[model samples]
Target chain A: MTEVLRVHEPGLFTTIQDTGRLHAIASGVPPGGAMDRFAHSAANLIVGNDRSAATLECTLTGPGLLIEAPCLVAVTGADFDLRVNGAPAPAWIAISLRAGDELAFAGRRSGARAYLAVAGGVLGDRWLGSMSTNVMAARGGMHGRPLATGDVIAAGQSAMAAVTGRGLARQLRPRYDEHTLHLVAGPHISRLGADARAALFSSAFVVSPDSNRMGYRLEGPGLETSGEELLSFGLVAGALQLPSSGQPILLMADHQTAGGYPVVATVVSASMAVAAQLAPGDEVRFAETSIETALQMRAVQREALESLTS
Target chain B: MPPQRSTVKVRIHPLGDTALLAELGTRLDTAVNTRSIALASALKKRRDVRQAVAGAASVTVQFDPDQVTHVALAAAIRRLASKRPPMEEPGRLHRIPVVYDGPDLQAVASALGLSQQKVVEIHSRPIYRAFLIGFVPGWAYLGPLPDELVLPRRPDPRRQVPAGSVAIAGHQTGIYPLNSPGGWHLIGRTSVRLFLPDSDPPSLFRAGDRVKFFPIAE
Candidate 1:
C-alpha cells in the first residue's frame, strides 16, 4: 500500500467514487457513482487503472493535494485548471509527480465536474463492494462523505507502470458544448400529450438550481397528465419523470430506487456524459430516439473507447 | 391467491439501454405487488441481470449489455411474466410501538371526519404488508390501510422530517429511516431504528414483510 497524498484544500464537493453499488439497489439504495462514466473511465485508463478504479470526482472546484509519493496521476472531465508546484499542468494526460510536490486545481475553465485518477487508484472505505460514497446513507468512501481538508488517502498497488506523458486521443474526448441529451420514449410518453411532447423538443429547458446528484428538475412546459399518479415504479438514471407541476426531473446517478411520477422518456446512456457537465443554469433539450439507435450509439462509443485504451 | 386475470397483459418497457421495466398493473394492489416481488426475485437469480429491484407494481432489471441483449431479456421477461407468481411464504411480522403525537395528527383526523382517537385505532388495527422498500434506503412502503384512514399526502412536503417519523399518504404508511424531505402526513413517531449501514444487510425492513403499529402513552 502506498500513502498517496494528503488533502490541503478540499474543493466544493470532492468525493472518492468507483462505478457505484450495483447489488444494493434492491434495498432501495441507488447505484451512486461518478456522474460522467466516460470521463471517469478515461481518467482511469490514462493512469493504467481499470475502468472501475476509484477516482476523485471534483465538482465546481478541486482539491489541493500535497503529493506523498512519486507516482503517475491523470485528470479528466470538467476542465479544472490543474497546477503542480505552482506551474500550470495539462489535463487528460498522465503527469509524473515527485514526493512533496504541490498539486492543486483552483479555477474551472468549463464543465461542472472533473475526475482525478492515480496510477494505482485511490483506496477508500467500501460498502456493498463499492467505494463510491452515498452521502445520504453516510456509507462508503472517506468516512462516507466528501473529502475535507487534512484527509490522507492511500493508493492501492499499481497493476503496471503507467507511462508518463500519455494523453487521451482528441477524437475520444467528450464534446460538452452541445446541450441536447437524446432520449428514448418511455412507456408513459403517450401520457405527455402531443402539445407537451412538441414543447419538450422545441423549447430549451433550463436546469433548475434545485438540481443535484439526485436529479435535475427542469423548468419547461407544464406537461399535463391524463390520469392520477400510477403505482410507484422502479427508476433508473436518465429517466425523465414528469410530475403534476409540469416540470420534468431528469433522474441522475443518485436518484431514488422508485417513484410515482410518470416517466415520459429516458435519456440514452451515452448522452449521460454530456448531462454530467451541466451546471444549474445550463440550458438542455431532449430529442427522442429509438431503442435500437440508442444501443448502436453505445456500441459505437464502446468501440471508440476500446481503440483508445487497447 | 386470487385467480389470474387474463384480461390485462404485463407491459414491459425499456429504461434506457441498461434496464427493462415490467409493469404488471397500473393500480397499487397486493396481488400486483406480489407479482412484482416474485418477478424481481426470479430475475435476481439470473447471471446476466446485475440488479433486480421491485417497485409497487413493477420490476426493473438492470442487466449487462455485454452479457445479455435487451431484446433477449425482454423475451425472457415475457416468458416469466406468463408464469403464475410464486406462492408467498409468510413474511416476518414487526410489532412497532408509536407515540401518537405528531404535527399532522389533528389535521389528518379532521380531514377524515373522524376523531383523533378513532383514526389511531383504525390505523393500528390492521397488520399492514410491506409492498416494497423504496423512495430512500431502508424506507419500506407498508400498506393496505383502512379506507377510513386513507388521506392524500400533505399539500406541501416537509423539508427535513426527523428519523423514525411514522407517516401516511394515500393508502400506504411508512417510517422515515433517515432525516429526509417527505410529503407524507405525519400521524405518529416511532423509536425503531429502521436503517443500519454498518450491518451486513444495512436495511432492517425488506420488501414483502409485515408491519403492525401499536399506540403507546407518550
Candidate 2:
C-alpha cells in the first residue's frame, strides 16, 4: 500500500529539502536547503528515512493532510498544534496513521521552521543533491516555491511497516537567545573603529521584516569603517556583513556568492541552525568563540546524531 | 583589539576566529594583495592553522585551539609579517568571455563618463586576479578593474541576473552562474561556463588566478 498525503491548504512557506548543495556556492549558487537542518535530520531518522532524503520543511502554518494507507510519521522543530482526523496529534513523537486518516498542522508556537517526515521520503526529482527550493532563483523544491492547495504528495510504500518500539520526542531547544549571535571576526574586521566593532557584540539587534532565507537584515547599531569602499571578497553562511548604512546583515543559506560590504564577523556553523529559526521581531545578540570551540561543538553534534543510528 | 604595528602604518584588528582586517594607508595595487597572500600562506603552515585568506590589507586565519591559543596565533602572525618575502607565481591566469549587452550596460558606461564601446574595451582589457571565493559558491571576485571603468552597483538590484552574466562593480568584475539577484552593472555575457556542478574543478576561476575578459556579441 502506498502512503500519500493530499494537501488541502499549503502553509506560508512549505518546500521539500534535503541536506542542500554545498559545493554549488563557489559557483554563485546559494546553499538552498533546510532552514533547521538538525530538526530535518532528526525527523528523517524517526521515520526510518535516510537523513539526506527529501522531507517537507513547513513554516508557521501548513496544509491539512489526508493520509492514505498506514504510515508512521513524526513532526519536529516548531511546536505547532498538530491533529490527526480532528484528534490532537503529538509533536516530536512518531505516530501511526491508518489509511484515510487526516493530519493537520496549525500556526507557530515557538520556533519558525518545522519538519514533517515519513518512513520513506517524499518522491521528487533531484536538483543538485536536494529537493530544496531556492525561491529567489525559482529553482528546485516543489517547483521551487511554497506548496499551495491541492498538492498531492506521494509517500513511499511500506513506509510504516517498521513501526515497533516507541521512543521519547526530542524538544526544540536552543542554547542561546536568538537576539544575539556569536561570531568569529572576518577578514575585514579591522577596518571598523573599535567603538563600532564593539557595538557588534555588545548591542542587541532586531531581525527586520525584510529577512528571509537569502539573508537577515538586522536593524540596530551601525559600523563605521575607515574606508568607504572595500574590495569584494569571499563570504560564508555565518558571515555578519555590514552594508553602507552600517547595519549588520547576517548572510544565510541562500546568500549571494560574493559581496563588497565589510564583514565584521562570521557566526560559527555549530550555532547556525539555531540562528535559522529567528523570525522577524525576534531579537539577537552576538557572542565570540574560538575556532577550536566552534569545531568541537560541531563534532559533538555530529557524534550525537551518529549515535542515533548506531 | 587593534594591533600596533611598528613596521607599517595600517591599523589592523582580529576578526573573530578566522581573519584579520586592516585599513589600507594607500590604495592597494596587485603588489600589495600579493604580499598579503604570501603572509597568509605562511600563517597557514602553522600546525594550528586550518585556513588563511588575505584581503587587500588584512588576513584571516583559521587555527586549531588544541595546538595554539589565540594570543599565540597573533604573535606568530606578527612575527611572520615582519619577515615576509616577495610572492612568486601566487596563482594561475584565466581569460573569460563576455557578451556585452546586458540590461544595465548603457547606464554603467554612462556612469563612468565613457562611450559604450569604450566601456567594453576598458573592461575587457585588464588581466584581473581572483581575490577570494565568498558570498556564494563558484562566485569569483576578480579585482583591480581599471579605475576609470569602475562603477557602483545598482541602487536596486535586478530581480534576477541569468547564469553566465558577466558584470563589473566597484573595482571588481565577475560572472554569475546559476541565476541570482545582483546589482552589478551587466556589461556582457560569457560562453565559457564559470560554474559547473558536475565538472571536476566546478569553478573555472580560483583565488589567485589571473583573468582577462573578451567581449562577444549578445
Number of the predicted model whose DockQ against the real structure is largest: 1
Which residues of candidate 1, in runs, are more than 4 Å off?
Answer: B1-8
Query: What does the lDDT read for residue A90 in candidate 2?
Result: 80
How would you encode candidate 1's per-residue C-alpha lDDT over B12-103 as one tens digit per residue?
89888888888888777888888888889899999999889888888988898878988899898877877887789878899999998989
Q: Model 2, A193-291: lDDT tens per residue? A: 889878877888888989988888998877787677765543556788888788888887777655668777888766777788787878888887776
lDDT of each: 0.87, 0.70
Worst 10 residues of 1 chain B by lDDT: B1-10
Predicted model with the maximum TM-score: 1
Kindly give the stretch of ten consecutive residues in candidate 2 chain B with the minimal lDDT sum. Answer: B17-26
True contacts kept of each: 0.73, 0.43
Candidate 2 per-residue lDDT over residues B1-218, each given as its tens digit: 34444474344555444434443333556665665667767866777776565655556564555567667777767667666355367577776767788777888767877899998888888788876665555777787888997777789889889888888887878888667788888878887766655554467776677888887665
DockQ computed for model 2 against the true two-chain complex using alpha carbons = 0.27
- Model 1: per-residue Cα lDDT over A1-310, one tens digit each: 8988899999989999999986777778888989999889888888899989999999887899999999899998898779999999999899999999999997988889999999889899989889999998888889889999999989899998768977787677767778999998887888877898899888899999999899999997687878777888778999999888888999999999888888888999889999999988999988888877888878876876676566
Give the lDDT of residue B112 in candidate 1.
90
